[model samples]
Every structure is written in C-alpha cells, then in structure tokens.
Target: MTEMEWEGEFDPMSDPEEQRHLLSVLDSFRSYRRLAHFNGTHVRRQAFYSLPQEHWTLLSKPPFSVLDSFSKLDDLIDCNAELAEAIFKAGFRAFLAPTLDSDWVASVVPKKYADDDFRTYSIIMDNMKVQTSQNDMEKARSCINQFYREWSAEGAVERSKCFEPVLVALQHEFDMRKEADPGLDRSAVHVLAPGAGLGRLVFDICRAGFSVEGNEISYHELMASSLILNHTENVGQFKIAPFALSCSNHLSRTDQFQEFQIPDVHPSSELADAIGSKVPAHERMSMATGDFCVLYSQHEHKHEFDAVATVFFIDTAPNVIRYIETVRNCLKPDGIWINLGPLLWHHISRKEDDEREDKSRGRRDVVDAGISDPGSVELTNNEVIALVEHLGFVIITQKFNAFESGYMSNPRSMLQSSYRPAFWIARRKPSSS
Candidate 1:
C-alpha cells in the first residue's frame, strides 16, 4: 500500500523484530547474487571436469566443442550476474525508499523505513556475514523468474490467456452498470485485487478506467513490483536472463540463456496515454502490502470495493472458507466478485506446511495475523464453486476449463507445463442467507 500515516515520528530500528526482518531480506538478495556466481562458474566447471578425459577429448571437436560450451556458459553467467545486480539494486531502493515518504511504512516494511538512516543501516547489513540457505537462494531465483512472467514480452501470451478474461469480465460489469445508470462515473469504480503479484492485472484494470488496489503479502514480490511500477522510466529499460540458472529441460543452449526486456510497456506512460489529464494515474493505482485476510477483514474495508478480481490467487489460501468470507466482507451489496485460477492449493503438501512454519516461527506479526493454519482444505473445482454459491454468491457467469495457461514458463524449453484454470463471475447477494 501507499505509505500510511503515523501518529508520531517513528523509528524503524527501534523495533528489534523489524530490524531483523529488514536485515534478513537484504541478506537474501545479497546471497542470491553470490550464489549466481558460484552456480554459473565453479559448479559448472566442476561438472565439466568430472567427465571422462577421453570423452571430453572426443567431444571437444566441432560437433560438441566442450570448451566452447564452457565459454558460452561463462558468458551466460555474466549476463545473469548483471541481471542479479539490477535486482539487488532495485530491491534495495524499494525497501529503503518508497514512492511516498510517510512516517508509517507499508505493513511488511518497518515503520519509518524510508528514513535516510536506513541507508547507513543497509551498509551494516551488507557487511555482516550470514549463512544463506539453499531455500533462500531458490526463493530469490523464483523472484527473478517472476519478472519474466509479469513484465516481459515473452510473458504477454500467458498474461493474455490468464488476465484478459478477468479484464473483459470487469469491463462487462462496468458497461452494465453504466447502461443501467446513465450518470455513473467510470472513475468511481474501485476494484480490489488480492494476490496481485507484480500488479500486471491491476495495471490492466487501471488502464480500463477503474481505480484498482493490488494487495500482496510477499516482500520479494512487493520489492520487485515496486521497482517496475514506480521506478521504471521507459520500456525495455532493463534486461534479465530469467532462465539462465535453469540447466535442465533445455532444447538448445540459447533457450537456457535467453534475455528478455522487462516492462514490455512502461507503466506510467501507458497509463498516461490511456487516461488523460482528467484523473492522475497515481491516484487510481495503489498497492496494499500484507496478508489479504488480515488487511481486508478489518471493519473499515467492509463494503468498500465495487468489485474484487482474483487471478491465479485463490489457491494460495490456507483456508478457502476464510478467503470467501473476506471477499464477502469487502464487497458492497450486489457487488461483483470475479475469480480465475486452478485448484493447486498452496498449503496442501507437508513440505509446504513445513516451509510456512519455518518462515513464521519467530515473527509475531505473522503469528498474530491469524494465518498460521497447519494445512489447507483442498477442494475440487466444482466443490469450490458450490462453496461460493453456498456462501451467499449468485453465479452470474462461469466457464470450467476456460483456457489453458502457464506460469513463468519458458516457451523454448524442452518440457513445459500448463494449467486448465476455471473462470467464474459471481455477485454477492444483498445479505448473507
């Protein structure tokens, strides 16, 4: 969310818990960059050396050119290193300096996190020696890959398949409302998008003449998205080799090292062009950084949104019933609720539950947020719809197997996975039954 207001001048470092969290996030980025170098050079070289000498000699010829492959891999590593550096710099800036300076920071960030003193604190964090786990490196790598999914030209096809339908449904809703009430203003339509990773769908909704707020809980995602949304000045301003670290499922070496320009379209410029001087783009778009249930379930948010649109988001909940209830609370009477996603429940697996527990262990904010449920209740697509219908929603339109889509997929990879997500538009009843 935009910077919140504080009752007094707050000091972020005063809170030991917040200080630790901030340092941990910064260290994760640093470790990610360091691991990229190790993986790109030392690990690959060791693997090359492990091969039989005779086979290496034979493969060193024109057909295989083992040495040449090493050189190419090195070059790819350099590209990835550059991308990692950019990610670190951007993430650091977003964490320390948000768009609007306020005494109170976003929920995930410490209060008064943007103070100039934090820059000095960042240096201390950089100098501190901390052990980085494999899991941290993997999470950092996934954050980089998300850039490819949300902001690159290559990701547009997937976005179109997944995001377009939601936009269309919203537009239809807006049109119907305007037709029924001739004096309705387009700018009055406010939409809440939960699990809004990188905010591509939120940006699309803003472009379609609606005020939209994107809610995200992951600091990794919020940091990266803030860079793209608020900091990016031009299209193709940044380039990243998202697939560089993946050594498997490659049809060709080129595919593994492919580079993609971020922000296929510059956010501000596109918004300005689509929405002229009548209303400023910044006022229409915002982000809320916290758990969706915690933030939206507050009484102030009740009946505050005209519509709630979810894209590949519902499955992340530990309890889908709470999600539905939160949605119901957020909407006005006869408000629209649009959902598109698969039934891949994020908390179903024991491994995922363990990860969640580990991440939430020492954080009081997380524990107090009421999200520490042990496991999720997995439901079939039809069962999910039945729950929605039973929870005081009238299905307006729904299509099962709406379309097949991919998430952060590499088009040139030898192996690709897809999901056949369900799509539905439902309206909240005047009151719960």
Candidate 2:
C-alpha cells in the first residue's frame, strides 16, 4: 500500500510524494482565484466521483443550442483526446494524488490515443477539473481569453464538479419524475444553480436536457462562465448552450460575475448592456436572481418547478432551515428536492472558538452576516438530519461512500481526502394545518 493509507480514512500524507500531490491540488485554485471572483473563501477539501455513470441521462444527449443543432456531436467529441491530453499537461498532474498509482489512472484514462477504448466517450472524458494556484488560473484565463478573442466567441460552458454522482442523482430524479407524472414535459426541467462559480455544475445539468440558469453574485466569475458558455454555443459546430446565465444580489453590473479574460458585452455601457440582455429581444438566453428564501413566493412563482437541486450549495448557506423553506416554496408539493454535497461548517468558520486556534483569522464579516441565526449556524450531521426532518420532508437516499464507489481516481491523493454526499429527495409534507 502507498504510505498514504490511514485507518478511518484514505490517507495519503505518509507517502513521499504526498506533499507534491496535495500541493498540486491546492495550487490549482490560485490560478482560478486570480482571474476569478472567488476570495479564497473555501477549498474543495475532498474529492468526489463525477461523470457518465452517475449522471448518464444527461451526457446521453445534448441539451442546448443557440437555436438548433448546427454542430454534430461526433465532431466535438472527436477532440476528446485533445481535451484529455491537455489535462495532464504540466502541473495539472497535481490533481492526481500520490496514492492514485499508475494502474488506477491508466484505467480511467484511455490506454492509447488511437485505442478502440478511446472510442467510448465515458472512457476518455472525465471532468477532473479541480482547484489550482493563481498563476495557473492566470494562464488558464489568458489561454481561454485568447481562444475567445481569436474565435470571436462569447463563453465556455462550465460543468459541475464530481460529475458522475451528479449524473447518478439526475438519473434517479428523472426516473422519479416520469413515475410521478407521466405527461410531464421532460424538457420543462429548469435548474437554478446559485453561486455557480465558473458554471461547472450548471453546465452538467444543462447537458441533461434541462433548461438551467446560474445565479452568480461575483462579477469576474460570471464573465468567465458567460464568456465560455456563450462562445462555446456560438462558434463550435457542436454548439451547445450550457445554461441560462445571470447575476443577482448585484446592485451594479460591474460588481457581478465577470472573469478577467472576458470583455464586457458592449464595454462602454455595461449597465445598458445588462438591461439590453434582459430585454428578451436581444438575449440569446434567459436569467433572474433573488434570495432563494421566499424568492419564489415573493416573486409569486410558488410551486413552480419540478425539481430544485443544491449541489455543494447548502453548505454555503448556513441557514439550512430558511434555505429549505425557500427551496420548498419553489418546488411543487409533489416535486423533488435533490440535495447533494456536504452541509459543511465552512462558508462560515466558528468565530466564538477564537481561542481554539488563531484569533487574528477572525471572520467578522460573515459572522455579522448571520452568525446569530441558530438554525443557520453550523451543526453536525445528526443536527442536519433532525433539522431536515423537522422541516417536514423525508430523506430518500444519500451516498456518503462515494470514495468506495470505485471511480478510477483515488480521492485521497492528498491527506485523507474523501467525500460524503447526502440527499434528501423529499416531497413537501401535505399540510394538515
């Protein structure tokens, strides 16, 4: 065994290369941070399984186009080898941890570029996109920006991280929806991904035949996602719309999601351009943003959607109670709520325990934001379950053992990295009151 194994978890810290692998993953984010609106707030911490197996129904077919099928699926996928090859270039190897070993990585990756195994989409394509350092982020931004500039493209579609599990969850939801309502328009599904940094998760859903809209609060990040998604759907013969893009919680246009490489819509009149984008006449897509809590009811869109998903989202919102309430308001009583990712104590580290570690690293801004809300405060898994149950919904299924699911990538490449995702596929308890 690699020196990286531990008793309760997969341990990679013991290996000589452990530091290199972990450092590589950590460094990836810096690159994104420089060009992105992310404030070094949260790190992924652990790895999760993603792609074809977990969310098969989505990658099964294309979801979007500027208007129609101008690009053939065969054409875009033909470059799959090129895309896969680009991943291992230079420092990206850090994404693979020391514990992974040659055999595992080889299994997940195509044996040879021309190998028949490469003919299979799932065998070749894996969304292993993870965090890197600022310099890498800068390089990525520069390259992406240049790609857009040269191609006269608008944006690249960002797909959700940990793709396989997301797909699995999506497949389960799709089956349930069909069973629940036979006449339902399968395509009427519209997903709202808040804090859609780089549009990863949003695009994954979009690839599933659902209409998606990402509500981003950060400006540059929005620009990056918008640029990639917009341009990808435009120039590529395999053009596909990632999702409906927009930024809310933003009072000013400049302050919303905009990545470094992308240029303003009109450059001179950003606010006017945003207004124009919303005009319905000039827009290539649709979008809106508001507090998810009471947002549906406030907007009079109560019981509007068939499903409202939160992937690595609930952790960001400390108020699970209000968050669920808001999600409940939007979902039809019989609608499904597929909640994934950790209910992390992160997004808000405990401020009261200042004496436990460093006091200078105090988080006054977030604490003041809502650190006072008892329900919003971080709690244990048991606490999460009690709260969700009290909210009057039933937990359907959760796969906390994704690490054991046997994906080709060993999640614990760095330290004891592994993921535990929970789901509460619930229906609103019929109100007797």
Candidate 3:
C-alpha cells in the first residue's frame, strides 16, 4: 500500500455510534490540505519535526482537546509537519514534569529518556524534526526514518513497535468481526500484507488462526520478519529476497536484524525440532518470496482462503487503485477486507477530492518531494467510499477515531480529523446476494 492506498486493516465495529463516528470522519476528513500545518512559533523548523506548540491547533475538525500529557500526543498529531514538537512537548510533560518544575522548560533537555514510554515518545518527537530545510514530502521520509531509529533504539525489535499498536487495534477489530459473524469460515483464513514490515502483524494474523503471506520489497525487512515468524509457533515467511536494506537505516530498530544475521531454513528439521515440541506441524509457520501483486494464480484458487488485509499500507501506495484492486483480486469472492491508518491523502494533494478520483501524482514523487507538494494524489471521503465500492467491496462497519486525543500529544491532536479513526470492514460483493 502506497500513498494512494489504505494498507493497514482496521478493526470493525457494529455500534451505531461508532458507525456515526466513521461517517463523521469521512465527512470531516474530506479536505485535509489544511491539516498539513506548520508550527509558526518554530519559524524555519516548521513541519511535525519542529518545536512543540501548546497553543497550536491540530486540525479544524471535531473531538477538540488540548494535549496536556504525552499519552495524548500520539493521538494529538497526525503524520504532519507539526507532530514532532507536539509529541516532544507532551512527552516531556508526561514523564518528567515533576523534575522540570517552572525551570524545566528553560533548561537544555536531557539526552536520556526518563522511562521507556518517554524514550519512545521522545524518539518519535526528536526524529520528527531532523529535517534541516527539506520540503514536507522529504520530511515525511526523513521523519519516518528518525522515528524508526529512536523506536528501535528503545528496543522496538520485539516490543513497542508500530506493529504492536497497529496489531492490537487490528486484533480488537478482528475479534469484533468474528463475534459479529461466526460463519465466516474461521479455519484456514488466508492473510495478505503487501508491504509486511518486520512481519509482526503477519505473525499476529497467523496467531489469530489465519494463514498469512507477505510481500516486502526489501530482503532485510523480509528477513527480520522471517526471523520473527520462524521463531513463532504458527506463521509463514514470504518475501522477494534481499530485504530492502537501503531503507533499513531509516528504521531505528535493528535488534531483530542483528538476530537473523543469517537466513535459516523455513520449517527446517532444526526449526521443526525447536517448534514441534510446542506448536503442532499443521500450524507451523510458512514463508514465500515474490511480488505479492503477481499472486493472480493464488487468487484463482477460489474459496482457498477467506480474506486479505493490509496495515498502514494502502495510504502510502503511489497507485492506490492498483493496491485496492490487488487486494480485491486476491480475496475470495466472499472474503473480507480491513485497514487501519490516517487517511494521508491531504498531504499529497492538499485536496480531499483527489483521493476519490484516479489521482496518480506518482508515489515516488511523495518520497522525493516534501510533504507540502500540492501535486500529490489524494481522495475525498466520498471518493474513498466510491473507490471501495468500485472495487466491489461492501462496507459493513466503520469507525472514526480521528478525534480521539489519545492518538497523539499535539495541538492538532485536539483537532478532529474529518475522517480519521476512519476504519471500515467490508466483504466482497457476493454475486448472488
């Protein structure tokens, strides 16, 4: 999932209030251009990487709340220019307030984290502002790299990774869906994660009783993901070789990479002996390597699996259409689709309507250009739904947590996303039903 795609799978909710929240998100988030804002107080250091602004506003939407605590900053800032400062400020206050007193803000900040939470939060904050003077698009890349570095240094290899928070959200949604409909063929459900990073989510998917297949562009991420899967009881390792290491430096967590310095046998006799003692063979982990988009034949195996999913992926794809279509092609006619992520289209086009339209400004351009480029491809709320419907998927439930301040600790966190918390669960359009 690239800039135009919605990769992360969202947990489903059947509550009318939740559904209303989803629709509200769709309505409010339609135009996110204004959402990409700078902290004027930081002057040259604008963007999410700059200094925090307690007086700043996260967005113009609903769920307004001040980010007074660090726990609130993640929910506060969207992936925008103003995120860094908000998180840093909120985190500093959250974990070290008593020490700072009135003189704290005036003194040079300490290098070490007071605790793990503050460390994670601080890393996220410091990394966000690493950009010296690059455009927003480039800052996105820079900040992402910075965030990963700090996250990994804090021992994200096995914990506190984006994988866990995203997966926890995914698991919650998955369980809710299962409870809502027990007839979806619980056994042997297949999972597809196109850009499966470290593969933690894949592990979770497999652990949830669904067989998972992943397509990562790099050998490094694939290897890291593979190591995790291999050691796990029920999972699989699928990749296209040479885990993309160029992007490795951008990612801060390297503990897993350090562990899997050598790729081992997939379900090898050695691995078998290691795992057979615990998990059964039938549920043993599996892995593959290849372009996931090329799995047309795998998709042709009709009724072979129940569903396909992506996480924090679709929104990053350069071609959102191809991404969605790819998932559609893989899923059984009656399978379900889920995603979780901020609708990041506004950063691309600064226009909500672009998201629904066949807007293809070029995904690579996003990586090259800064986040402020107006020529990006983004869709409006109506467009996202239309696009999903066009893909022949029926939305069964949706939830919008765009307004939830628990997401970040920024002034924007106080502002509501027009459609953040924009989560939806859908089923393939049954031909007869």
Candidate 4:
C-alpha cells in the first residue's frame, strides 16, 4: 500500500476548524518539544543519540529553513536564542520537579507546569514561540489530529514493513493459482485472515477484487477497527512519530502519544477507487472476533475456505501444531495457506491454574502435548516445515526474510528488533481416499 503523497499546502487561515485543530496540536507539541529540550540538556546527557530516531526521513537535510507554512503567525519568538539565555541565566530558577501528586497528566507528567522553576518555565514558553519546518514540525502540524490513528491501516513504518510485503505475496500466489488452473474463479476466491489488525490487509485484498474476512480476538481492537473501517470516511494520509521516550527513562506503559497522526490514511488512487467503487467496505469484507483456532471447530466450517492467510499470527497459540491442523481442516483440498511472521512464541506457560482458566474460557482444546513444557513449546523452521508436510501439505514456496519490526518499542532505547519472519505458501495435499 503506497502512502498518499503530501498534497496541497495546509492553509490554516482558510478554515476555522482546521485553524483551531492546528493551534491545539501545536500547543501540545510545543510542550512536548520543550520537555525534550529540557531532557536533552539536563536529564539525558546523550539526548542527541538517545532520542527517538526519526522514522520519516525528510528529503531536506538539517539546518532546515523555516517553513513558509507557519510564517503567517505574526507573533514569533526564536527558541534558540531563548535557550542560550536560559543556559546563561541558569541558577535563577528551580525546575518544577515531578512529584507523587494525584493529578498525573497522561501518566507521563508527574507535576503541573504551574509548579515548575524559571528554567522549565522559560523552555516551555520558548518552544511555543519558535516555529519552523525543521525536525517534524511541518509534517506534525500538517496532519495535526491524526497522531493517534491506527498503524496497521495508516502509519508509514507498518505500511512499508508489514502491509506492503503481505500484499505482494498475496498477489503472487493469486497469479500463480490462476495460471495453474485456468478454471479458477478469481472473483469468487475467498481468503480468511486471522488476527487481522485494523482490517488493512482485508480491505486491501478486497480492493484487489477478492472475497475476504478478518478474525481478531481483542474486543477493544475489534471495535476500534470496525469503527475505523466502517464508520469513518475519506481520511487517509497520516504519520507516526514515536517520540515518547523523552517522557520517562523506562517506558512503564503503552505510549499512545507515539502513534499520533496528521489527517489519516490517504489511500492510494487504486485503493481509494476500489473502496469507492465496490460494495461498502463493511459489507464487502467480514470481521469476526474470537479465537481463530476455535473458528474452524464450530462444525460447519471444515474445508471451507479457499485460502488462509496468517500474518503475525500462528505463534499466538501454545500449540502451533494445532494451528497447522486447523488450517489443514479449514482449507479445501489443494487450498493454499500463506503465513508470514517470526516464531516469537507468545504462550509463556501451561500451569494448572492457566489450564483451568483456559478451559473456563472455552479453550478446551488447550491440552498438554508432553513437550518441553505445556506452553513454551518452540519448534525450529525445519521442524515446522516437517510437521506441515506430515499433515499433508505440499510446500509451494518458502522464504526467510529479516525485517525491522518494533511494536511501539521505546524510541529512546538502543533496543531495535529484527524479525526473521518465515513466509510460506503451502497447499493441502489431495486425499488418497
């Protein structure tokens, strides 16, 4: 999925709503930027290195000129000059130290700005005064309110690393299948995507003219995805800036601020046209929320789907063998299974209490297989392939790809992740009976 290119310039003076939204965003960002400057100077001695690396690499190099976008604002104060003066006028004021106060703002800020010393006060005010296109200033203000948009459907980082590869693979498999079988019904081809985050893949598949469904387990995510896919209209271009690491040394909680957006997914012309031309997205694609393993066991779905695409799923279960079995049973004879993700085992343990809890929650199939442990069973790539073949699957294509992937990881930490995700397309072996 190609990101929507930045279109016409943002005219803040033209629209009052847009103007209000822009100022509000700028206000918040100024506070955040000031906080970063403070940490860069006092707290994090290596802030230049320790800060979150910019994901959206700008074309223009550093020493960026002031954006013409914000030049309209008449009252402006240079932050650099004020910051230098603050360094000179240092001992005059005490920074407002965070406290164990009840009024915690966003769980990151422990104290109110009202209690800060002169140094902290000056920095905040200076940030509010300075306006430039340097850093993420232009992109940030351009797409003001969209910072919290879902990454699966909108963010740049996820689109490049996750969605793009999956889309290409799906197209490759479809083309191959159609070539091998001239009678293949392209329009009627049905694919099931388990653990579809925000329905981006499913939506894109539908955009490519296929029948698709997405299955998710998290209620909150399911609802959110539904609202975004079905209710929202014509919002596409968004950005993701993971700059929350400056708030705290150790990331204690999920950083919601990191995923903020501009507007929201500005779908490519192809995607937009497909979505606009087809039956409403909500009607064209289906989203089911529940355990995917239990989905096939519901009696009527055996060997039902034409294809099963699992991206970043599979390892969610304690027994991935069960997932293989489920896929085998769910796919029609010679039906394909496309999987792409690391074997990052999610199940930590199968303690008696955990087993009881699983059963109570209707996960009766979670039985101990007498492996190394109940839940910590991890299989190598070769072992997984062997097990798939044993279950009567013929590997069509297989590949090992390493991609940078981090699920809202701390932007300040040197901790980067690379998932050596294995991609495989296997077909159910025809029954000999």
Top-TM-score candidate index: 1
Name the lDDT value of residue 40 in candidate 4.
32
Error of 4 at 176 (Å): 3.2
lDDT of 1 by residue, 1-433 (tens): 2331111122234456444554455556666645776776568777877889887678778777767776776666565555555555665555554532443333334445546443433444444443444555566678777878888888888988988888888778778998989777667788999987777888888888788888876655666676777777789887778877777898776787788888799887888777522466667777787668767877789999999999898888777888898999999889999998898887765375336433553335444353554446888888889999999999999898757888888888888899998999999999772
lDDT of 2 by residue, 23-83 (tens): 4333332233222322211111111113345454443344522112212212222232132
Q: Highest lDDT among the candidates is held by which one?
A: 1
Candidate 3: minimum summed lDDT over ten consecutive residues — where?
1-10
Q: What TM-score against the true fold does each predicted structure earn?
A: 0.86, 0.45, 0.41, 0.55
lDDT of 4 by residue, 195-314 (tens): 875566776777776677787653223433443454344453223334333334533323313344322553333354673323433334666655676666444778778888888888
Which model, 2 or 3, shows the larger TM-score? 2
In model 4, where do residues sit more than 4 Å from their true spots?
Answer: 1-154, 180-185, 234-259, 266-272, 275-283, 349-360, 363-376, 409-413
Task: Output candidate 4 Cα RMSD.
Answer: 16.1
Q: Rank the candidate models, highest lDDT first.
A: 1, 4, 2, 3
Angstrom error of the Cα, residue 95, model 2: value is 34
Candidate lDDT (C-alpha), each: 0.72, 0.41, 0.40, 0.51
Report per-prediction Cα RMSD to one decimal: 5.7, 21.6, 18.7, 16.1
